[model samples]
Target chain A: MGKLFAVVVTIITVVSTAIFIAHTWWLPPDISAHGHAIDRQLSETMISSGVLFVLSQLALALFAWRFGDREDGRRVKPFPGGATPMVVFAAVLVGAEILTLTLVGAKVWAGVFQTPPDPNSLQIDVQAEQFAFYFRYPGPDGRFGATHPELINEASENFFGLDPARDTSARDDIVVPTLTIPLNRPIALTLRAKDVNHAFYVPELRIQQDFVPGLTIPLHFTATQTGRYEIVCTQLCGLGHYNMRAYIEVLPQAQFDQWLKDKAAQQ
Target chain B: MRVRDLMLVGGVGLGGTAMMIGRAATPPGATISGKVTFTGTPPKMKPIDMAKEPFCARLHAAAPVLTENVTTGPGDALRWVLVYVSAGDQGSAPATETVRLDQKGCQYIPHVLVVQPNQPLDIYNDDSTSHNIHPLAKVNAEWNKSQPIGAPPIHAKWESPEFIPVKCNVHPWMHGWHLVLTTSHYAVTGEDGAFRLQGLPPGKYTITAWQEQFGTQSQDVTVTGSETKSVSFVFKATPY
Candidate 1:
């Protein structure tokens, strides 16, 4: 029975390690410039963890097979170097791994979040509501209008509650359901929420941020490719959260300008 | 003399039959009909842009559709106003007919729909694109599902009386309302802003009219048997 148990444990360890190395259910390809660093950090962590897992499982299997029940009444033997060596070994190894991960993780986070956006980056405002997201761009006036909650009527399409009649600056504000930006350019988004807590997650971009009501959070990213990706809400705000998704269209500079022009005309 | 007596008997029998038919034709109930009007200028409805969905945009390329938030018809008659018995002692029963709401042109066919508690609601997506139907109900269980193009319609029923806001997650501009009530006596105003609630028992009841933007207005009314009562509601509009 003990021999069989050792064999089963060995098989389990081998299969799991093989699956981890195969990378079958891995993340999609990183499409952002800063995404490479995040990928590297993830790979390093996985490798270290994978090695630890394999060593521990194999040691357990070896001990079970070597120290099985003996009918010869042999005295039991304690591990070499007693408990102190094993304790010290675990502390040193785990402590070093934790230290390395923390330092690397902090750098990666600071690079993506703490670094200021470029001066010439295009600024866009994002409003997360019950079950949808609306993106607003500063029109030719290069200004955002003040929002009034009372005037926010979805039926009349005054989604942002910009009172054009009273607020002159709001007249040129362009609001659209989708986010479009020029590729290879730094894009900064000011995220705000209307009613409840929500999250903005773009898997390909390796960016995620939360939108808290009454507070505006800023996120900056640059897309290296010109393609369309889905922006899904990760927060469970309401019943419509699952369906709350929008598309991000990254276009060339000239094409993005034309798209803005078309949207402006509609506004 | 015998012929004259026989004719008299036949005439008497015919008169009794006619009286019985007349009584059966008119049930022992009252009716309430009214016009929901608004004073002051209503906010202009902006054109809806379905550019996110190319198919929906192309469907309305020839003629654009306006928002239905505060739709006003001729003579300031408010459309899509729900008028029903807010407070009354009428026994309720689930409607036998299934209420159907269609998603066409990326917009709800009826901007406002009213249903009784536990009434079956059949929602269909008649457009070529997909739609996610989400009903945000606080008192009742909230549910949402995606219906792809040519997919089967969703069959749902609400067990509680609450006002639910329905929206298509895929299409942000698509919004609607579902009023679940316990009373079976209800009416929704058309373009003419006219509604009629018939077969109401004779009693003192409260009639309420609810507009999506202007809120609700209610009044107490007394109904007598076999009578038609006329009522009118005027909502003050704001041009924000």
Candidate 2:
């Protein structure tokens, strides 16, 4: 019986260590901004988690192997001291991790969301609908028209449901489905939802912002990559929501300038 | 006893089927050709906000107003619309490719194209607001995803077959067609309402022609590399 217990304990230790070492196969999909923070915290946290997991397994194994099944008349003695220090140590470790994570997390989120748009930042107005995104440029005027909320309709196909007939300011508006922005520039996006809540998420750029009507929420991001990436709607709005998409053209600085000039002339 | 047997069989069956599907599916390229025309009445030329819709309003020398409404009365002017064909192969039977559907000026440009099975079909938002690519497909994966400016592009494909209706939820005036075909031979109507599907395998086949408001028609045809087969699909819809 003693031999049997020892063998089981060895197996448990081996399996635990194997899992800790070979975790890449089952690494969770990294889709959040917090994933970036992990680059700094990963090696430290992983080493700690791995060491603790192994040590606990080994301790449990050693205890089981030592005191498991004994035929000899050997009695165990109770500890004069209780396991208080171990508990306190664990609490301190967890508390420290939480505090550090919170501090670092607050900073990362603030960098993307908390700051207001810089005056020179390029701004685009986005309206989310059932399964698509329509982008608006302020034209040369650089101002969004005063739109009525009740005019928002997806069924009558009144997406953005703006009553152009009533809202005279909307007459000069240019509505396009794709968004083209210059590279290496800070862009402030103003999000609005026509019918329901929608989220704008670009994976490569690590940006995700929600669109809510009746409120013009602004989100800012700078694109580090220049390739054409996809702009997908991350909100569940309706039946045809699975294939909603928009093109994001990141032009060179010169081409971008030409585009702005062309746009201005057309306006 | 029945439940236990079903569980054992279902797991193995699904696994085997999935593997076979993966083997059978192969991706072959498809052709996307269609015409842009004023369907009912062509709207007039107006200067549109260039900052908002940059790529869509391509007419530099022409008028700039990106009118969402179709021309109410008829004259031959380039219309705005997007048309593409895609197929849904639930199992892996062929190659995987994708096509783009751009929604600009409240119309679907290029009105028709073809897609392969299990390809990542991208739906684009070019207008300055919102639109939806509502594909009414059953033989394929039927779902809806939205796109806001700077949002991730919606990547979808088919695992089955069906005539899909693509609509913009935000722009009630915006509508288009997504044709998901198993075969590669298909065409879209041009300004003169003509489409030709070339390079068909040497065999007798049933060909179909469809229009959004005009309805659909099918005909029997034979094709070979040496033969130039002529086919016409007409939609007889009286003035509504």
Candidate 3:
């Protein structure tokens, strides 16, 4: 039974290690500027953890095979240098790894979140409602309109509840269901939730932020590729959460401007 | 045997008379009919592009559906305007018939639907794709659910009086309204922009005509027994 146990343990260890090395399930390609830093940090963590895991699993298998029950009545042997060596080794290895991860991970996080947005970054207002997302652009005035919750009527496409009759600034506020931005240009989004909790998650962008009720969260990213990607809601807001997605179109500067103009005309 | 037969006949007659009397206790109600007209030029509705869902796009390949935000017909008559008794005595019990709202071709069949509080509402997804029905109810509990193709209809009810906005998250342009009221005497204007609120008891009541884009216009209407009250509502439209 002991021999069988050792063999099973060895097989499991080898299989798991092989799977990890093969990278069967890996992240999607990074398409954001700051995503490269995040990717680096993730790879570093995975490598360190993978090495530790393989070494520990192999050590466990060797110990189990050598220390199995022996009917010869052989005296038990303690590990070399006793428990103190093991404790010291674990403390040093884990402490160093944790310190390195913390330092590198904090920098990556700060780069994506804490750093101020570019001075000329395009600003867009995003409102996450029950099951859809509506983006608002300030139009030619470069000023956002005030949102009136009572005036929100979705049938007329007033998803943001901007009262053009009362607020002149709201007259030019352009709202669309899809998000369009220029590639290689920094874009900052002010995320607000009209009803419940929601999240903005873009796998390629390597950025995910929660939309807390009554609170506005800011997120900024620069897309490296010019293509259409989906921005899905990761948080389970309701039954419609699965369908809550919007297309993010990253276009060139000229095309993005033209698209904005067309949308503004529709408004 | 003759006496028993006579007694049975008398009992049946008494029961019939009591039922008639119960119905007669309430006077025959009055009706309010009117047309909803627009004064200015309504905004042009843009055609929806259902290209995201090939199933819906193919369904509407011949003729694309336009936005129903402001569906105006001939003579400037507004369509889909909900006219209901806003304030008056509570009428009879809610209709037992279930109100059905269908999602077909990625659009809400009835752009605007009226239901009484606690009335049964069944939402069905008749398209080949899935739809996420979300009713944003402020006074009542707000909920959302997804209905896949061929899935059983969703049975839901609203407990409070509110103008709930219904939307399909899968199709962002798909929007509808569910107006929940206490009175069942309501009518939605058709292509002729005419509505009739029948069986309204003789009393002073507030008649409200609500258009999705033009907001709401209400007037005080007094109905005397079995009289047809004529009320017309004119909404000022904007291009935007």
Candidate 4:
């Protein structure tokens, strides 16, 4: 029975560890400028924790197999250091690992979140509703019009509640479900929630931020590759949260400019 | 015992024949036709902005789709009003036919659809993009499901009568209504604001007209035989 228990534990530990090592389910390729650093920090944390996990599991199995089913009623012998030194040593080792990771990880985190956005970066306003994401680009005037909640009428496709008839700045505002930006250019997004809480997550870009109702959050990122990626909501906002997703298209500078021009024409 | 059994059998046979004859003697019923009109100020319909969905926007680029909540017709006529026999309905047949609701150009076709209780409703996504159909049904079971492009149509039905408001969360601008009616004698007004409730049995009935934005109006009317009775409803509309 003891041998079987040890074997079961060993198999479970080995299989789970092997899956991680083989990258059976890994993150998508990094396309954001700051994603490489995040990936490196993630790898370091995983390796450190994984090594500790394997060692501890193996040690437990070995001890159980050797002394678990001793039929002889012999008095159990304690460890040489009376368990205090061992407990202290383990605690210190785990604590140091956590402390080191946190210290190293904070730099990568700060780089993406704490740093100021470039002054020339394009600013886009994002409004998340019950289940859809609407991105608004400041038109030629480069000014966003004020929004009135009372004026918001979904039936007329007035998702942003802008009074284009009276507000000149809102007349040219281009709102779309897809977020299109120039590749390698900094992009700052102001996120607002129309109803409940929501989250904006793009795995390829390594960016995830929350959208709190009644508050506007600012997030900045720079995409290095030109491709179409999915932007999914991670928060459990409502019944349609599972279907809440949009597309993010990164284009070259000239193509992005032309796209903006065409969108503005439609507006 | 033998005599009693023979009498029981005779009674059963007579009862069955009489039921058949009674059903055959019923008339084709009366027809109630009406026009729904409004007085006072009506809110102006604004053009829908489908710019979120490029495919839908391009489809309606020439003439953008307008809001339908308060759709008005010529000469104070109101469209999309539901006229039905609210009272004096002599039982209703079980609905078996499937009703279709389509998502095209990022909008719900018909805007307002009427279905009987337990009737099958098939929702199809006709656009290239995905759509999540959520019916905010309070009395009946509320369900939210996604229909992606090329996916099979969703099969659903309501067990109880309710005025369900349906919306596509992916496209917030996509709004619609599902009115589950218990009476088979009902009609929805067309663009001309005309409605006809056919096959109503001869009796006193409370004819009700329901407008989404203007609330409901009811009037009592008596139908005789298979004659056609004319009824009109005038709703007071507000600009706001």
Q: lDDT (0-100) at residue B21 of candidate 3?
A: 17
TM-score per candidate: 0.67, 0.47, 0.76, 0.65
The structural similarity of chain B in model 1 to the true chain B, as TM-score, is 0.87
Query: DockQ values for all predictions?
Result: 0.26, 0.08, 0.22, 0.27
Error of 4 at B30 (Å): 17
Q: What does the lDDT read for residue A225 in candidate 3? A: 94
Give lDDT tens digits, candidate 4, residues A29-106. 999989998999999999999998999999889978987788996747866688898899878998998999999999
lDDT of 1 by residue, B1-240 (tens): 011121122223223221121211333489888899999877766678676576888988898877888888888899878888999847755565566677888887667777777878888888898898888899999987989889998998889999888877667788899889888777777777887777789999999999988899999999988799999999998775
A1-267 per-residue lDDT for model 3 (tens digits): 566677888898789878877878888888999998898889888888888887887777776788775779675876689999989988998899899889989988997799989989999999998777889999988999899888886666777888887788998888876788998999999999988999999999998899998998889999999998888899999766776778788999999999999877866
> What is the descending lDDT order?
4, 1, 3, 2
Interface Cα RMSD in Å, per prediction: 3.2, 8.2, 3.0, 4.4
Worst lDDT window (10 residues) for model 4 chain B?
B1-10
User: How many backbone clashes can be found in candidate 4?
Assistant: 0
lDDT tens digits, residue span B129-155, model 4: 889899989999898898889999999
Which number leads on DockQ?
A: 4
- All models: lDDT? 0.81, 0.54, 0.80, 0.82
Per-residue CA lDDT of model 2 for A1-267, tens digit only, reads 755776787788788677767874544334333346444455555666677667776777777678867667676654445468667877898789668767866676676568676688887878876567877776655666666667663322334555555655554555566677877788888888766788887766667778886677888766655667778778776665665667777787788778766755643
| Alpha carbon deviation, residue B23, candidate 4 (Å) | 27
Query: What's the TM for chain B in candidate 4?
Result: 0.87
Candidate 1 residue lDDT tens string, A1-267:
667788999999999888878987888878898899888888888898888888988988887788765668675776579999989988998999899889988888898889998888899999999878889998878998998877886766777889887887887889887799999999999998999999999999999899999998999999999998889899999766776778899999999999999877766
- Model 3, residue A86: distance off in Å is 5.0
